[model samples]
Target: MDMRTPLGRVRGLGSTNDGVKHWWMQRLTGMALIPLTLWFVYSAVQMSEASHAEFTVWVGTQGNPVLLILLIICMFHHGQLGLQVVVEDYIPSESTKMTLLIAIKFAAIVFGTSAVFAVLRLTVGSS
Candidate 1:
């Protein structure tokens, strides 16, 4: 007696092409973040002992705008990827996983936008 159904035997078995995209995106974002995060941390540490006026002046520089934007982008992208992996690994129900993923994406968008806006307001308003 054959153990497999005719349909199962004939159907091609493999991924639907999602795995490679997800992996590549994760690694790409991670690589982009390394330099951005290092610069952020270094700037933060440099500002650790700065007075208010000094700190504001430092951030008012042109380089700071690009750094701040990079930080915001990297932060949200990393957050989204991390949350996705968590949801995929732990959430068993399809409905729940989908809901959580959507929620995470929106939350990341809202928070990231707000953060960038706040940074811009501070930097632009100061000068």
Candidate 2:
């Protein structure tokens, strides 16, 4: 029951069935960023003249830490997804593409974790 075309057979190209999930996640994260980004900008402006202790206290306040963590997660995840699409589309070498994708994911996790940890420390230490 071979249905693949000659060219497809030659190239061994086939669907991995993962594109839809990736696409949906990219769109969802992008949509989520809009409000989160606005909130972050508004908060930044509001806290522009805040002292260090005041800023820490603000972070420790109700909902602020949670919002900050969500912002970090969505920001890093969205960036990683966009970068993966770009890398997959443009990069011709499989090895290079795989290496880059791995690096991107790893960096995103490390940086995102550090950002969240910093926020948690601020919230906890301030309390």
Candidate 3:
């Protein structure tokens, strides 16, 4: 009494409903990283001679804060996805795997959120 469609069963794509979503997220984050990383590197290179005050002022600019936030988010998201794949693949125990995945996700969120908050502080005001 297989519930899967004939083709699904044949292709070994049975009802693991999250497969497509996981794959898509990985690719999407990877794509987002390209431009973000390029911009970051370019900005860093161009700012190589900048003093601390200049950098802080630059961070307070209009779009730089948003770009920094997005960069932090996409970087962490991409890293979390890759680490999840590794844990899923290499970790043997189901309990351990689930624990590691949850920890990875939690850490990513915490770190990413704090980073965005820090950027906001830099961009908004000195206090």
Which tens-of-lDDT digit does each residue in 20-75 have in candidate 3? 78789889989999999999999999789999889888787778888889999999
After superposition on all C-alphas, the RMSD of every candidate to the true structure, in Å, is 5.3, 3.7, 3.7
| TM-score winner between candidates 1 and 2 | 2
Clash count, predicted structure 1: 0
Error of 1 at 56 (Å): 2.6
Q: Model 1: per-residue lDDT, tens digit, 1-127?
A: 8899988886654322256677787788799889999988989999999998887777777799778887898889888988888888899897998899999999999999998887787787555
Ranking, TM-score, top scorer first: 2, 3, 1
The candidate maximizing lDDT is: 2
Candidates sorted on lDDT, descending: 2, 3, 1
Q: What is the lDDT of residue 44 in candidate 1?
A: 94
Score every model by TM-score: 0.75, 0.81, 0.79
Residue 60's C-alpha lDDT in candidate 3? 79
Off by over 4 Å in 2: 1-17, 125-127
What is the Å distance of residue 22 in model 1 from its true position? 2.2
Each candidate: how many clashes?
0, 0, 0
